[model samples]
Target: MARAETRTHPDTADAALLEGGRVGLSGRWTADQGAAVEDAAARIAGSAAGAPILVDLSQVSRLDTLGAWVLERTRAEIEAAGGRLAYAGAAPEHRILLSEVKLRAAEPAPAPRGRLYGFLEDLGKRVVGAKSDLVTGLAFFGEVVTACIRVAARPGTFRGTALVNQIEQVAFRGVPIIVLISFLVGGIVAQQGIFQLQRFGAQSFVVNLIGLLILRELGVLLTSIMVAGRSGSAFTAEIGSMRMREEVDALRVMGLDPIEILIVPRILALVIGLPILTFLASLAALAGGGLTASLYGGMTVDAFLARLQAAVSLHHVAVGLIKAPFMALIIGIIATIEGFAVEGSAESLGRHVTASVVKSIFMVIVLDGLFAVFFAAIDF
Candidate 1:
């Protein structure tokens, strides 16, 4: 066997041309040679140039796994580029190392999705999420009912002080704003009704329109939306803060039910407070309507009062009041659910609080629509 020889630095590998288009590798081909081994491999591969090339390894003073893998990768690249590479005179150990160090081909990138596919995927995800939320809401409602039953069974377990405090926060402090908004809405409605009805020489009927609309729809609906935005958001923030601080877990450690201690009181407060607030809101709206009638419609107080009394029935008042507690329950449940879902970050708390308000207000409006359909179907 005629061995090929290359003059090179003893520590770093080098490649050189030899007889019969052969490439001879010399010096140490190991990790210690680092980039030199890779450069030598690159030289061998580049020298192939669409023709057969032989690599004579007999002159290599040392060989390691890293050097073998680099040479193998270079061979693959050259072969992929329509060139040929062959090894000769490699020792048994070098042959085994080269045989065992095959390079895997890179995987291809995924194809891009179209807009219709992306839209369908997003819609499916949201539909699944909404279903999950509905199930969670129903389960939480059951837990709340169970807690209420337990408190009812053990009257002493009820937190009267907490209930009163929450009532003060949710209802008493909320009175001025609720009253003012309702009054302004009522005046606007009455003014519009008069303006439109006067064209038909029936401006007197504005009193009837104001009475029925305020009592049957606007009063309780506005109050529920305000409460959802105001006290519902507060509930979520308070409970979410406690959740972030691990106080909920602490309550469980103390052998107390957090539902009874924290949730029931707030819910009870909403249930108790909402009706009173609704009644007050209705009365304020009626007062505003009466004032608007006196000033803008040129109707006397006595005549407005008579028309209102004759137009509105106890049935309309009952229908509005009937929806109040259910609306309160919906708001409380949604708020508490969002609160308990809070994670350990301030951002999580803020996100859940915002979600709580949005969900509560949306559900309240839906509930009102359902009530309207039900009451109309049954002739209530």
Candidate 2:
């Protein structure tokens, strides 16, 4: 107590000489030491021939976390001031800390895209599965026909109001476009027929050629193609939306058979609708051929009608009707299967709708080919 001891503050003393290139740490430091480190670095930055500050951590044997943070901050500030700060000595622990910090700050690696092709292939398999299910659904066709017969036997099922809306969509909605297409198609067919028939000096046979082709091929093929684009897509979209909304599940919960209630009715509608539409298209096409013959081929309307009557056989007309209902069944089954296969999403719905249209078109063509072969073998 009697003797007064003098002690030096290292930071105070070193701050003056640090303007050139110096750093001091004589005591233990906490994180709060950053402010003093920054200030000292700033003054040193303005000095002539400013050199980097180097802090000696060799003596920092008892450093707390805050002390370590302070020492790191001082080094950074000194370096940022256009001076190089070197560690006189680095402990193994210090290297580990640096490595840990770097590891923590590193960016995450990217997700792998290697499985993309496999994923797409799996999606294709699902679509194929849906198509298979649709074909298997044909096992229900006889049941559908039985139900139709039951409904027909009662005749109340044919009430005007019940049918009017359907007729409007299947008939009126279809009529104008069908008429327009049939007319243009008939004119084209007539023009083509005239070329072939004229080779045989059989210009009058143009009527027979157009009528027979229209009834046998164009009626079934064109009608099916149109309905595939229009009604097949409609069925897929309708059923898919209902599936997504859990409405199909609701029907199941209520003990209503989805196949009988939903699928059968639509199939029935298309089967009935297609034949009716084909009949109308046939008449419209005949009218179109008559007009073409009258205007270009120098054939009168009466003569064209008579030639058409002679050319088209009752068997051809019957074959076309048989093909119509089968085509309708294909379209309906494919569409409904696609709808049921839809997962609960808008993208799935759209994809299924497109699939339904494509599958229906393919099935229609295949069935028509089969029918042609069958009829030929049977000599129909």
Candidate number achieving the greatest lDDT relative to the actual structure? 1
- Measured against the true structure, the TM-scores of the candidates, in listed sequence, are 0.75, 0.62
Clashing pairs in 2: none
lDDT of 2 by residue, 1-380 (tens): 12112126543212333222444334333344555544544443444144655554444333345445444554555455665655545467754553343312336796666688779979999999777765667655666666667666866544445445555665568878887898888887888777778788887888887888889888778888988998889889988999999999999999866765676667767878899888888777878888887877889888887777777778888888889988988888788878998998899999999988998898899999998999899988
Question: In candidate 2, what residue range of length 10 has the lowest lDDT sum?
Answer: 1-10
Let me know the TM-score candidate 1 reaches against the reference structure.
Answer: 0.75
Q: What lDDT score belongs to each candidate, Candidate 1 first?
A: 0.92, 0.71
Tell me the alpha-carbon RMSD of every candidate: 7.2, 13.0
Cα lDDT of candidate 1 equals 0.92
Against the true structure, candidate 2 has what lDDT? Answer: 0.71
Can you write out model 1's per-residue Cα lDDT over 1-380, one digit (the tens) per residue?
A: 23334545676798887777798888889998878888888778777888888999998888999999999998998889898889999999999999999787878997899999999999999999989999999999999999999999999888899999999999999999999999999999999999999999999999889898989889999999999999999999999999999999999999999999999999999999999999999999999999998998899999999889999999999999999999999999999999999999999999999999999989999999999999999999
Q: After best superposition, candidate 2 residue 171: deviation in angstroms?
A: 3.2
